[model samples]
Target chain A: MYPTKYHKPASIEDAIAALGGGDDAMVLAGGQTLLATMKQHLASPSDLVDIRAIEGLSGIAVRGGSLTIGAATTHAEVAGSGDVREQCAALAALASGIGDPAVRNMGTIGGSIANNDPAADYPAALLALGATIITNKREIAADDFFTGLFTTALDEGEIIVAVNVSAPTKAAYAKFDQPASRFALVGVFVANGASGVRVAVTGAGEDGVFRHAGLEAALSADWSGSAVDGVDVAADGLMSDMHAGADYRANLIKVMAKRAVSASA
Target chain B: MTKVNMNVNGKAVSGDVPDETLLSQFLRETLRLTGTHIGCDTSQCGACVVHVNGQAVKSCSTLAVSLDGADVMTIEGLANGELHPMQAAFNDNHGLQCGFCTPGMIMSGVDMVARYKAEGKDLTSDAIRAELEGNICRCTGYHNIVKSIEDAAAKM
Candidate 1:
């Protein structure tokens, strides 16, 4: 990692100020991915404004048929929250399966979505659940928040403060994981909420997390496992790598979607 | 350089280290706590696992300077005169081949057992295997490691 000044900001205002004061400063949430990226020389920030110490940045609250999770809240916290379990069990299950226990301990929901890894599990959940990414500047919907792989719509000094998700009536996430990395080879999140059935797929698209309209339409018309039988994910824009071929990923996407649908149903 | 202060194994230790210093480096180099190994030096391998504020964390992935006022525990602090139940169980179950991953394995085991027990959840062998996903024993000695954790969970 390059030499950088570290600032432990106690408040969101101080954190934003610290971020704006430096040259290429980055917000350090959990440092599970950022630290590794820095060590590999993939990123070198002039300053690191640590936000986990900031109060009001870590908690889970369920109110008005929605779940508002503070940005700095760890995956472990969300997975163990009784409120989350009762209100949105699928989100809790996704948090529980993110990585190993240690990774989950240090990885935050804010950090995960902000990084927006192509194979990350949170993006699928966020997109399917219609989550709102609340930043110091303003709130952005998950659809507008995630721009691409390893990229988000966040401005240079913007910091994610909290994420608010609408409670889903029925939801479940299914993933075919790459054994060593635990990243999804292909993952799908299915949700039946106020907006109707939404199906989001990750780890297979060349453009990062995307919604499968065919599956969504089919499921919205008939919410059942067999509803996905006629829907097929094309390999046109799917990612192909040594781990899996594009066709294989497309197939896995359908399989995972069916599994998620069945689980939710 | 930044002045980092934290309690390690009940000792109030402070040092002026670089801002980029990892917690694993702080423990092993500054405090000479060599029991916390740095296998892989990345987050993938949990050889750098330690207890930060009573929660299992990969020290290599955490910044030392950011952990001010936090309490940390390592493999060296697990025993109180006698071996900790997890440590003794590891020995009895022959859970070590190279002993390279034992420290992290034991640390994770103690944490999983405590968490599962507190939640009133059964720490089954399958559950232990799932929770051990972070700590890797490349020696393929997971069978004994699982047995040791199960045996230790019963006693814990």
Candidate 2:
């Protein structure tokens, strides 16, 4: 790892100020990904603004009919929260199945979405639940928040404050995990909510997590596992790696979607 | 260099180290506590697992400077003077062959039991296997490890 300065900020304002101070300053949340990248010399920020110490950045609360999860809240916290399990069991299950227990203990939701790893689980949940990503500067709808792989609408020095997900009537997620890393090979989230039915697919997209309009339409008409059976998911623009081919991912997407719907049902 | 102050095992220790120094490095090098092995520099292997603020975390992936004022418990801290219950269970169950992953497995098991106990959940065989996913044993195929944790859970 390259020589870097570390700053533990006590407040969000101080964290932002620290970030603005350095051109290549990076916010450290849990350090599961950032520290590993630093170890590999893939990312060498001049300064690391540690935001784990910031108050009110790590908790779960349900307010005004929406689940407000603090950005820096660890995946373990979400997985273990009674309120989260009661209000959004699918999200809790997603959090619980993220990485191993240790990784989940250290990795934060803010870091996961901010990095926007194509294989990440939160993006699928966010897209399916119509979540609002709240940053220090502005609030972005889930559709607008995720731009591309490892990309978001967040500006430089912008910090994710929290994510607000409206309560869904029913929702569930299913994923085909790559055994070695436990990353989603092809994951699908299905939801029936006030906004109607929504389906989001993660881990198989070349362009990152995307909503499956076809499956959403089918589920909107018929909320059942069989509704997604006839929907044909194209292999085009899907990720193909040594783990799985694009065609296999397309097939797994359908299977996962069906499983998610069935689970929710 | 960054100044760090933290409690390791039961000892309050402080040191000044480079910013790039990982918690594993600090424990093994500065403190000379080699019990916490670094099997994989990456976070995948749990050989470097330790309790940070009472939560199991990968020390290899965690920076020492980040743990300032935090309480850390390594495999060395599991026992007061004799073998910890989990350690004894592993020995009795022959959970280890090469014994490379024992420390992490024991630490993770102890932490898992505590977590499940707090939640009023049983530390059943399936639960132990699921919770021990982070710790990898190249040998012993995990059957004995599961048995060991089950034995320890009963005693704990």
Candidate 3:
């Protein structure tokens, strides 16, 4: 990896100032993806703004039927937090299932969502649960937040302060995990939240994480495993990889949708 | 060079390292503690697992500078002249074959078991398998590795 400047700010304001100064800087969250990309020489930023030291950026809070997870909160913390488990069991389960024990313990929610890897599990949950991403600039809805593959609505100087996800009536996440890296081959998150029935699928679609409107409509009418049995997600733009074909992914979407509904029940 | 301060094995140590210096490189090079191995530069491999603030994290994916003032525990810090309980269990259960992935496996397993015990929950094979899903072991096929974690949990 090429040498670069490392700045550890005493506060979030200082970090923001460092970022605002016109330099190609990458906010070092968990470094799970960023560091790997750097080592591969895919991304050579001029500076790294270490954000781990910023106090109050790591926590889980539940109030008024809303669960707010701090940006820097590790996946392990989300999985282990009684507040998260009690409120959003699907989110906790998703966090617990991400990568392995080490990855879960170290990787942060902010980093995971910001990276927005096609196969990442959190994106599915966030979208299905109608989570709001509270960044330094503004709060963006989950649907609007994720623009495209590996793309978020965040500006260059913006930082994710926390994610405010409303509690759902019933929700569950299911994934066909890839063998080697444990990333999702086709992960589905099903939720009947205050915003109504929502279904989000990750890893299977070529467009990255997306909502299955047909499945959502079917399940919204009748929230049951069998409700999703005959619904076929279009394979037109689904991913075809060594692990699974596009048709296979489309089929798995229905299966996972059913399983998610069943699991939540 | 970036000047950073970190606590390793309960010792406060400060050093100057390259800005791009990985936590694994810092441990092995600057600190001269080579117990943590880097199997893959990518975060996919758990060969460089370590505890940052008592939680297991892939050290190779982290920067030495990012760990300033943070507590770290490597495989070298797991024991003092004697094998850690998890290490002993792995030996007795034949958890390691090539031994290349042992340190990471042990580090991750220690955190899992400790967390399980703290939660007052019983550790099962399924749970251990789920927990060890991140650490890759090409040799043992994970049968004995899972058993070792269970045995260690029982002893604890």
TM-scores, chain B, all models:
0.98, 0.97, 0.95
Better of 1 and 3 by TM-score: 1
Tens digits of per-residue lDDT for model 1 on B28-141? 999999999988945788988999999999999999998999999999999999999999999999999999999999999999999998999999999999999999888966
List each candidate's DockQ score: 0.82, 0.80, 0.81
lDDT of 3 at A154: 90
lDDT of 3 by residue, B1-156 (tens): 879899998888888888888899899998998889888767776888999988888898888887778999999898878888999999999999999999999998999899888888888899888877778888869999999999988876
Model 1 interface Cα RMSD in Å: 1.1
The stretch of ten residues in a row with the least summed lDDT in candidate 3 chain A is A19-28
- DockQ (C-alpha) of model 3? 0.81
Top candidate (DockQ): 1
For model 1, the local distance difference test gives 0.92
Candidate 2 off by > 4 Å: none
Once fitted onto the true fold, the runs of candidate 3 whose alpha carbons sit more than 4 angstroms away are none
lDDT tens per residue, model 3, A1-265: 9877888776888999888773687888887778789999998988888787888888998899899999999998998889998898889989988877777767899999999999999999999999999997799999998877899999978999899999999999999988777889999999997899999999987878999999999999999999997686788999998899999999989989989999993
Q: What does the lDDT read for residue B128 in candidate 1?
A: 97
**Every model's TM-score:** 0.99, 0.98, 0.95
